[model samples]
Target: MEGNEMKAFMKRVDYLLVGILLFSLGLNFYHLNNAGTNTYYTAAVKSMMQNSHAFFYASFDPEGFITVDKPPVALWIQTLSAKIFGLSDFSVLLPEALAGVISVFLMYILVKPNFSRTAGLLSSLVLACSPIFVAVVRTNNVDSILILTLLIAAWAVMKAVDQKKLGWLILSVTLIGVGFNIKMLQAYMVVPAIFLFYWMAVKLTWKKRLLHLIAATVVMAGISLSWAVAVDSVPASERPYIGSSQTNSVLELAFGYNGIQRLLGQNKGTKSMGSASTAVQNKDNSSTTNTSNGQTPSNQSAAASGQAQGTTSSSNNQGAAVTDSSSSSNTQAPMGNGAPPNFQGGMGGKMGGGTGGMFGTGTAGPLRLFSSELSGQISWLLPFILFAVIGLFAEFRKTKKFDMRIKFAAFWLTWLIPMMIFFSMAQFFHQYYLSMMGPAIAALVGIGWTMLWNYFTTNDGWKSGLLPCGILTTFLFEALILNQNSQSKFLVVGTVLVGVILFILMVQRMKKETYSPALPMAALLALLILPLYWTGITINKTNNASTPIAGPGSGMGGMGGMGGMGGGARMAANMGFPGGAGNIAPEGAQDTSGNSASGSQTQDGSMTPPTNQDSASIPASAPANAGKTMDNRNQLNTALLSYLEKNYDGEKYFLATDSTQTAAPYILNTDYSVMAMGGFSGSDPALTPTKLEKMAKAGYVKFFLISGRGGMGGNQSESVTQWIKDNCEEVPSSEWQSATSSQIQTSFGRFGGETLYVYKD
Candidate 1:
């Protein structure tokens, strides 16, 4: 215990922590140069970097047509990165990657003081190799920065509690506010835990604590709303329409769409503006319904008008399935009235389902975090953490006295429990949102490990029993998950075997009345093997940037075939268990109804899923953008850009489309801006007839590209198409044909089949 010995020990710890951080950096930064990782966000970042105004508004297009659906703080960081590094796939994603790396070090700092250095290192290591954490930081998602900011706030709060410094507490609250800017209300999920920890551990009187919390709340609100207030102050005519807000209001977007609507999914009155438009566009009661239940009005109009116009065979073929191109070589019959709905709306009613039922609990419940669909994302070690939490509580109950360490455990639990409940029952969350649970799980694992080590190394036979019981239980849970989801028989058998061996070794060591670091180390290392292996797969394999979950049997953009996990559409079909080959639901392939991941057919719609080969051809980093209704295929077609530039001179907007997905690649590829007429879901009224007429008449938009099927559901208006047919002449597919790559054409459905039409009014 001499000073020199302590210094040497500390040096080794620092080196190990530094090494862990570097390892995380390598995983995140390894395939940095891949393009279009998540074109939705990448394109938005590119657009934001075009000018300061666009940057401030977080515009998804260069001309400030529409901002992205989320808050701009995270986008601001990415914009700054792109500005410094110059725009590329790597530049836009660098800030988040670096944030993730910093978070690893911060987790260690937050844990080491109250717990042993061993606990802190293990915690940091677990977080560093977390599968979802690795996947999220490597993408353009706002979550990486969001999670990091929250961790910083957590650290600040912990320090304030330990040191009794009011300033540290203030800084903590301020950082949470910053986190709110990064991801709106999602960051406030930890508030209850923060408040409780402060109240319990700050040593302040009840009155002082209440007043301090009020002040912190006020500051947090002021900081969180700073940008939202500024954006809302702008006139709708001046700023881009708030992309997903029902009333084009930032506040409404925050509290409504991204807030409650996300938590509740799509409820009666709380549907997103996009969903509303989709409903209107796809209303079944329309006059355009099948004239005889076998012939849709739109199809009738197409057939009659086509022959009247002396349509060529190619154009006739084009009318059936391709974009409204003049050169259609192959012809097919128009879709009959019995055709299935073209587009699925409102995530297929998955968002706002009822709460998980009672103690039995439904999808959104206390156990929702451990559900089949969610567990693999970040819950690989959840069973252990949960058991450790129970053990910690039991120990505190026995002592009947307040321990700072127990209080810290309380804060971590408080932080995790509510969020767990919220995510469990919340109807509309994506899997990546589970990363919010990462830090809590890591801290609990560390604290629990240290506590168990102390008990087991001593002669406390009864207390030591908790270790084997917890470890064995976790092993059983993981074994079940692996058996159901994994393709690797070796993995399942090996994991179970290792558990048995570790159990025996620990029991033997305890009985011998000996304390060997080797036995405990072996046990802990064995526990880590499975999750770390999965994390490695996540780092090496292609992730479906759209769904953004990591594990075996991921649908699209995954190494689906390797494990027993089903890949691609096959996994989508099975839907039996998490990480199973059939688990993934492609972005637009199915509604939230747990329906089969089969293709939706629109009678005349041009959209198609990428062929398996085409999907395989996608780079490890490139996530295809076809979910929902937008298709982001070959955005950088040199031929298309040159053609648009040559023929559509002086146009303010280079191209116009009905959905954001269709416009993303074009905006990203060209210096010119592209307008998404209806916003993300093709339901926004941003480009009504009047607006389109005004822009088209003014030469603001010279070319309109009709690449994919329309309708928020499958009810695209014939009037919209009729208006274009009446006012504009169809540009031949030949001019833009060069823009279609064989990769896109042969895999036609993959990128909405590149059905090109250049319409000039």
Candidate 2:
């Protein structure tokens, strides 16, 4: 081939790759008009834009009263974007959207140097269309940014090893450190992968490698802990109380709540995992013991049931347990005919245990990713990738020294194996966290495909035979997923067609005794059809950006009732907190995956079903802080806001609530600060009785809003609720409806369906 021909060939590949990138951008930005799905972060973005203190502290409101349960880095980007773009939902989410596009590009570049351009493009395509990757990127969740930063970090380290450049190594760890600032300890999962890649691929002496790693670790820790240290350095009184901390220490939060809890699955409800069926019995025993406190067993049971039904009850039985007992109980709640009660019109909540351990409940094993709720979202191509990985390792078994491809493959395996185990065993995690596995999965898929392509096109009988077997296995797994989740015949038909095509292609290649490159490509394309279709469904069917998921049915493939396209289903009406897949918010708390407080035990390891949320809009698993659009649940009760503003005109806080949920939307929509009296999870002791008394006396706080069934915030939420109940007059919902009576009311009735009360002098 001549130089000009080679240049033209490269140009076409570049154009095709560029086209794929644009396609990814389009998918990410499709229906991107959400005013903010994750309102917890949305409110923070608003507050940060309005108040310098809020920006610095990452507070949930402009007054710097309390921060979100996360480090400020991810929100900082959104805040800056909102500041420049005028604080719309689109502005806040733009950074993540751009990150999604760039991640696809980076994945391509990452793969291209070691493999063919075709392999690079295919990997990028896989990453781009990955359901959860696309879903999270399109929402306000911090995972997208975290994923991007980690990808950049991986790229940097890869370059570091390739060029033996210390600068690249520093740059790599620094980016990982930045990711730590975005999501704290969750970002460090990839550190081992990075260190190993560098160690294996770099031509450094063993001692020098160890020394270099030590220095990298130091830099990484400094960057990772800098913000936590800074926030902790400030006196608690001067800065917003760190949200989601048991001891009000971010450092403690780093190690205990977010760090070890994730690794060991030492969540609140974990102790009861063996006894999930006996939650009621356990509650009964506890109630009997506490009977001397004037609470009868019947009353305790009633309160527990009421709490389960999202009625006006405060006590959480489980505290910070990770097991979904409420959801589990709801699952086991017998309606006489063996049917569970429909809290909403959605599908009954399916517990993790069933025949084959559907959602990782009954079992925690190596194969957890191959089955269950987590499987569908991120693990679709995982099995094929794993087979490819094994084949690559086996094929290269004779080589005594590691090559670039082998080293790269090892790095990805290092990345995938740990996370797979973590998610498999961890009692608490959301499906979106699986986004971390995207790059590794994509890399393996690319490497595997490239190898198979080479093997199939060549005259290697065993390799050719294995290609067909792997394709068959992947098709069967996908078909099983489709059958389990969708009522659409498209999946069934597609599966059959894929099988037929695979059979024909395999026979043609094997009979001719020669490899046809197009046949393998055709098989690969056929395999992608179902996931691509599912991705399309996710893009078009997803209404609530808060808990974005991919499937034929709305909201994480929960419903077989609303199969196929165009369901016209509204998104979740008003999810309370941090409500995404597997990331269940504690009762009356926002989703606090990383923070200790919100991640703390709810009374029971159960989720309150979002009342009247569109079944289509909620994820299969309701996350804390389920999404509510500005026009939907987020529209502040104008009359209520006006009443507070007018009556408490000069007050520092317009209103106060037990948790951020009751306050965040008001702050975001009204651009007025409302005090989160407890914190994000209503568990933070940010405001004690003394603090409240002082604030009330100072006229800095007033107009307390008692929203819904307030949590017994351990004692903090209960204390504040009691204080407001004793000192404040109940404000009827009718009076609260003075402003939006003619407009659209929230799904529950009006203005978040929260009962409001104003503090009286």
Q: Report the C-alpha lDDT of model 1 over 1-761, residue by residue, as the tens digit.
A: 99999998887668888889998888778765541255556667777777887788887777777666677889999888867866665676788889889888888998898888888888898888788787778767788999998888888888887777778888888988888877788989998988899999998788888888888889889998988999878655567766644345678667765677456543323222223322222122122111111111111111111110000111000011111111110111111000112211233533223311110112565766565555666787887886687678778878998789998888989988887878776754556677888889888888988887777777675777667666776776667667656447887787788788788877877778568777776676667767777677765654344345666635332221222234333322122111122212122111111110111222332112222222332322223432211122222344555677788786677776654545654655455677655344433333334444555665666666553333211223234444565777777656764423423333333223333444454
**lDDT tens per residue, model 2, 1-761:** 99999998887678878988999999888867532256677777777877677798787777777667678898999888876766655776799999999999998899988888888988898998888788778777788999999999998998888888788999999999999888888899998899989988999899988988999999999999999999788766567766655445678667755666554442233223223333221221121111101111110001101111121111111122111221112111111001112322234433332211221222456766665455667788876886687678666874666788888888888988888878777643445677889888888888888887666666465666667777777887888777766446785767867776786668676777556677777777677777777777666653335445565433322222221223313322233211222122221222221111111112332112222232232333333333331112332344565566666666777777655655655665464567765454444445545446556766766666554433323334445567666776787656655423322223332112355666556
Which consecutive 10 residues in model 1 have the weakest lDDT in total?
309-318
How does candidate 1 score on lDDT? Answer: 0.56
Q: RMSD, model 2, all Cα superposed?
A: 9.7
Q: Report the lDDT of model 1 for residue 597.
A: 13
TM values, all candidates: 0.78, 0.79
The global C-alpha lDDT for each of the candidates, from Candidate 1 onward, is 0.56, 0.58
User: Which regions of candidate 1 deviate over 4 angstroms?
Assistant: 1-13, 267-367, 555-639, 713-722, 738-761
Listed per model in order, the count of residue pairs whose N, CA or C atoms clash below 3 Å is 21, 30
